[model samples]
Each structure stands twice: as structure tokens, then as C-alpha cells.
Target: MRPKLLAAVLCLTLFGCASKQVVPTHNESRVQAEASLKAAESAGASRVPEAAQHMEFARQQIADAERLLVEGEQEAADMRFRQAEADADLALALARSIPLEREAQRATQQAEAARRSLQ
Candidate 1:
């Protein structure tokens, strides 16, 4: 019984140490989220309604992440930052794609008109 208890304590101690090691002391996720948000804004996410909504959500997530960090909730804060980054990235993509989609539609219309004229 004594040996079993000692082994269990040792295993728990090792597990605790390993878990602590896995958590990062610095919040790189926050930095990435901020960068992504900035990129999204630069891409003109506000002009597209969906992108704008995502950007706003990202901002809120970032704010929440900051608050979490203040409360010593590093893991939660990091997760929030990651979520914000994803939203911002999505916003950026939408902002870029909408214009391209419009252009593609216009080109397709022109092609159809040209074919009809040739006929």
C-alpha cells in the first residue's frame, strides 16, 4: 500500500510539472491576434458588411483577452486572442474576395455579351 501511494504521488508530481511546462509564460497568441486585426483593418474590412461584423467581434475578443490576462488567466486569454485572430483573418479574406467576385461577374457578363454579338 505504501509503495502504491508513493508511486501515485510521484506520477502526479511529474504530471503537474509537465503540464506547467506546456503552458507558455509569454502570450504570443495576443501579439498574433493584434497583428491579424491590424491586417484586416488595412484590408478595408469595414467596407464589407460581413467582414465588418467579424472585425468588430475580433476587437471584442481581443478586449476580453486583455481583461483575462489582467486576471492571471493566461490560457483563457491566449485562447481568446487566437479566436480574435481567426475572426480578423476572415474579415481580411472577405474584404479582398468581394471585389474579386464582383470583377469576375462583370467579366463573365462581358464575355456573354461578346458571344451574343458575334452570333
Candidate 2:
């Protein structure tokens, strides 16, 4: 019974160590970030000040992540990739919101004008 328990403990310890060796790569996050950046650009993020800033940040983060990956810093690279993805997504959302905001402003103006006329 003691030998069986020892063997089980050894196996668990080895398995845990092996699992730690499996470094996670963020390739999918990188891909998603690139896609989001492209979509933001397509949505005219470059024309929006805040959105452009976020887009630039995303690009920088991606570059940094790539460098980290080459340096074998898988955890740091993964974090940067995720940050890049978030920035790109935020940029896209901001770009999309600009047009909607303009539309809302126009509608508000129209409503005000109609109210004035009725009064």
C-alpha cells in the first residue's frame, strides 16, 4: 500500500511538472487582433482620433508580442497578444460608434427643429 501511494504521488508530481512545460502560445489572439485591426481600418478608425490611437496601440502591442515570442517569453507574448486584440476591438467599436453618433446628432437636431416649428 505504501509503494502504491508513493508511485501515485510521483506520477502526479511528474505530470504537474510536464504541464508547466507546456507554454501557451497566443497565435489565435494574434490572428484575431490583426483581423480586428483590419476591420477597424475598414470602418474608418484612422479618421477617428480615439479609435486611431487605440489602433496604433494595438499595432504596437502586436509588434511587442512578436518580439516576446521570438525571445521565448510565451506568457508575456500571450498577454500582449490579448491586449492587442482588446485594443483593436475597442478601435473598431469606436469607429463604428462615430457614424452612429453623427446620425443620432442629426436626428436630435431634426426633432428640435420640428418641436420649435410646432411651438
User: Lowest lDDT 10-mer window, candidate 1?
Assistant: 19-28
**TM-score of model 1 (CA atoms):** 0.73
Candidate 1 lDDT over 8-111, as tens digits, reads 99999999988874554436888888899999999999999989999999999999999998999888888899899999999999999998999999999999
Per residue, candidate 2 scores C-alpha lDDT tens digits across 29-118 of 778788988998999999999899999999999999999999998888899988988999999999989879999999999999999999
Task: After superposing candidate 1 on the true structure, give the runs of residues whose Cα lies further than 4 Å from its correct spot.
Answer: 1-26
Predict model 1's lDDT versus the native: 0.91
What's the TM-score of every candidate structure?
Answer: 0.73, 0.74
Residue-level error in angstroms, candidate 2, position 33: 1.5
Off by over 4 Å in 2: 1-24
lDDT of 2 at 78: 90
